[model samples]
Target: MPIEQGGRVSWGVDHLPYGVFSRPGQAPRVGVRYGDRVLDLAAALHDEVFAAPSLNPFMVRGRAAWQATRALLREKLTNDMAVTEAHLVPLEQVRLHLPFEVADYVDFYCSLDHASNIGRIFRPDAEPLLPNWRHLPVGYHGRSGTVVVSGTPITRPHGQLKAGVFGPCVKLDIEAELGFVVGTPSEMGAPAGAFEDHVFGVTLLNDWSARDIQAWEYVPLGPFLGKSFATSISPWITPLDALPRIPGPPQDPEPLDHLRRRADWGLDIVVEVAINGEVVSRPPYASMYWTPDQMLAHMTSNGASLRVGDLFASGTISGPRREERGSLIELTWNGNDPIKLADGQTRTFLEDGDTVTLRATAGSITLGEVSGTIR
Candidate 1:
């Protein structure tokens, strides 16, 4: 039977984001989102690569294969809709899993506004930015093992607080961000231009934070227990080819030769961060200071190898406006000012039952949303 198209589903032919999904009795397999359905790639294309539980096996096939598969998917879905309709599984009938097996996770602080906001709030008496802020894309290796799929419950972490006291996190927060999925592997180093060759797709990310814990421990080495507890990501990975890339924000001092991009890689993704059920912030990705390509180049400039399924994210995507703040610390000014919700409640930080969701769009393409409720 032909799939009925009635109501609006943001997912269309232009946005065939890939994910791993499974029916009740079936094992997880690769599928692509089409309208409100998931087209089983293994069944539709007769390829075992899609039979794998995660996207890693297919991603290892490299750029040419990725491009060819995308083209074939478009062809089958459009011209052969009658034959392909049989393989379409209703989105609700399947459970979405992490699209790929994450090999390594790196989160970069690439937003100028977000960085300045943090500096202003924490180091109010000092200059807003660190001296080395403009020199490079400051980042920290994140715990890949803790990266979870959307809808996963995020338990508030416990750690040492100010005055050497330890307790449950009081300042639970969410960082609305964009994550880049790596498909192709590289040896010693990859240049800025090689971002397209290595990256497979993009996904929405929520870097759950324990601000109180972070404030006490992140002085010399940066975040540990405060951030590594849980990082939620959207199940669908939107192909890089599907997004619209605009010119990135200009750099004050031109980047080093290795970090200089031959082409603009800045994404025009607009991200919305919601608390409980109310939309609180709408951070603009185009306003970010460092591009993903520059981040990759800088990451690999020191001879770090890129592995298939490696994930990297653009740190909080904030803008100049107060409403554009991506994290609770900045949005609330470190709990100085509370945000009033639609239900007549004010929140300085996340409560035990609070749910945070991060949704994004690039032009007409709706990237998958990452949501988690605090437990």
Candidate 2:
């Protein structure tokens, strides 16, 4: 059956993504969204293929299995092939949980526009970009243990800034990024092409920041306790195969053969950020300087290994326009200018009680909606 036959689900067929869900009395089970209900894949297939607490076991089966599951599920869903009412659960009645266990977390500064803007603001005296920025993807390892599923409240992190002043992160900011989930493990010496084979899907990630603590502690080492406090991600994982390809910009002074990804790494994901109920920014994912494949390639260039469920993030995807900025630091120019809100309020950074929502859409298929409130 064609996916087009299943009329307008919240995240329909093309988005045919997977996640973990639990009902009132049931334990977590892998499920797929179809129309306004969630189909219990395990129950529908009458097997334990999707019976795991997270989607890791199923996702680790590689792309062939992923396609098979999607095809079988799509047919059962679209044509009502073998699905029964018992296998379908109402979306509202079920609670969504973290879809995968993050074995490792890595984040990349892949957006040239975002990097350049931040560079000018923080290091105005010298050239905005470092010499090696364009040569390779700049990234740092992050705390995976603290990664929370969407809707989880982020506590205002407490830390020092300029010798114990303006603490509790007066500059509580949000970095809107698209994260890639690795389902297949890679060898230690794998090259950029390995990304195509290892990466499984994508998700919306919010790297909440404490700008003051980061400013004080970032030197010598990248980030520490400030960034480790909390990070939020969407519940659903959208497979890479479900999305269309939009190639990234050409690399000047071409990369080495090992780093060159001949295939399309760019994804035309439209990412939006909103405060309360008003939309603030809509940064285009295509504006990123480095692609996902390049980041994966560059990450392992030094003989590093890739693990299953390892999450890699594309940081703060800002665009050419002011309104396209992904972080509050760029949007409000480091609190000098406050952005006006819909409810007759203005904010330079997130305040307590403020709910921030990050959403990404690819055509009619929504990757996921990752939202959290500042506390």
lDDT of 1: 0.91
The 0-to-1 C-alpha lDDT of every candidate, in the order given, reads 0.91, 0.86
Q: Write one digit per residue (lDDT tens) for candidate 1, span 122-202.
A: 889999999989999999999999999999998889889888698999999889999999998888653333889999999
Error of 1 at 1 (Å): 13
Task: For each of the candidates, give the backbone clash count.
Answer: 0, 0
Clashes of 2: 0
Model 1 misplacement above 4 A: 1-9, 189-193
Cα deviation of 157, candidate 2, in Å: 0.2
The residue pairs that clash in candidate 2, if any, are none
